[model samples]
Target: MAILSASDRDAAAYPIQSLFVPFPLVCFTLALATDIAFWQSGNVMWQNFSAWLLFAGLVFGALAIVAGLMDLLRPRTRPLRPPFLSSLLYLVILSLALANSLVHAGDGWTAVIPYGLALSAVTFFLCLVAAAVSARKYARLAWRI
Candidate 1:
């Protein structure tokens, strides 16, 4: 009946995937901000920051994906359906992050600024949607428990 009963949390790594999900969201949002700032202020520094943020987001997203996979493979006290869907949603967000990083890899600031910013915005929105879906699923699961 509880949200996460003792048995549901087997160890420190229980729900580890959730811990990493926010990292990319934060980084990608900052990347968008820096991209816009670069476009407005003509600051090369902003472009550099955006590049680093994108890279960080990808790295963190990879970690999250790994954790999610591990969770999926392990036995669980809770139903796996909602978490599986959540993991799929996270995978989509990670794919977008990878694509956004590749876009940044093109020619310098001029090539990526506005377009990359738009991509980041789209990715961020998707992340929000994924989070919402995951939250709703978890809430439904909790009520059933």
Candidate 2:
């Protein structure tokens, strides 16, 4: 058997998009937590943290979308519509996250005190839906084999 080093390996075999899946989940989840904390304590610091988390989530989520697109468009792979749709859903979540982050960019506690929290809540709900759909799609694929 021949062994391939990391650099020598085919990129498609690595599932780069899957590697990125947890980042936005963690970031967005933490953002929600921080928003709650900011509300409870009236601390500006938590609001600031939530904003940064949204920013990071959006950045990583974009990278993940690119990787997912590459995977979806791979030359020989079967046309997997569910996963493709799941990616589209993630893109929507990413867009919402970007908007929510901008909302947080306003000055002081007013930035994230009300509207930001609401937006974040909706974005996080979409994330859960996306994750669930993707899981279902993966399970279907696994069962087919």
Candidate 3:
């Protein structure tokens, strides 16, 4: 029985994209939480945190998409690949996340307050509440930073 290291792995043995699924979920969910915190406390730090989280989520989500495509393209994994609708859904979510990333990308420096909305790491809790509230829908959201 040969042992497989992380670098020796392939999609047929284990779906490459499976390794990446949890990351976008975690990052995007946390970004939503930080967005809420920034709104609730008027904290620039939370906004910064949310921006970084969104960036990470987008990166991971992109990787997952690439891995999924590679997996699906390979003949060995063809039969095991996810259905077309599910793949389309995944792409849709990634696009939404990309837009969400754009939402988080702006407004680090305050144009309104004039004091500059910046960062403060000491001012955060785990603060995972908004993940359950389920109100961060992209289509219905207003397009503002």
* Every candidate's CA RMSD: 4.2, 4.2, 11.9
Tens-digit per-residue lDDT, 1-145, candidate 2: 9887754454235465777878998899889999989989989999889989998998888888787777677643333434667777888888888888999999887898789899888888988998899889778766885
Top model by lDDT, which number?
A: 2
How accurate locally, in lDDT, is each candidate?
A: 0.77, 0.81, 0.57
**What TM-score would candidate 3 get against the native?**
0.62
Per-residue CA lDDT of candidate 3, range 98-131, in tens? Answer: 6555555666534212211222111111112222
TM-scores, all models, native as reference: 0.80, 0.84, 0.62
Number of the predicted model whose TM-score against the real structure is largest: 2
Clash-forming residue pairs, model 3? none
Scanning candidate 2 in windows of ten residues, the lowest lDDT window is: 74-83
Question: Tens digit of lDDT per residue, candidate 1, span 9-74?
Answer: 753234657688789989988988888888888777888888889999999988977877776776
Q: Clashes in each model (backbone N, CA, C under 3 Å)?
A: 0, 0, 0
- 2 against 3, candidate with superior TM-score: 2
User: In candidate 1, how many Å is residue 119 off?
Assistant: 0.7
Poorly placed runs, candidate 3 (over 4 Å): 1-12, 108-145
lDDT of 2 at 114: 80
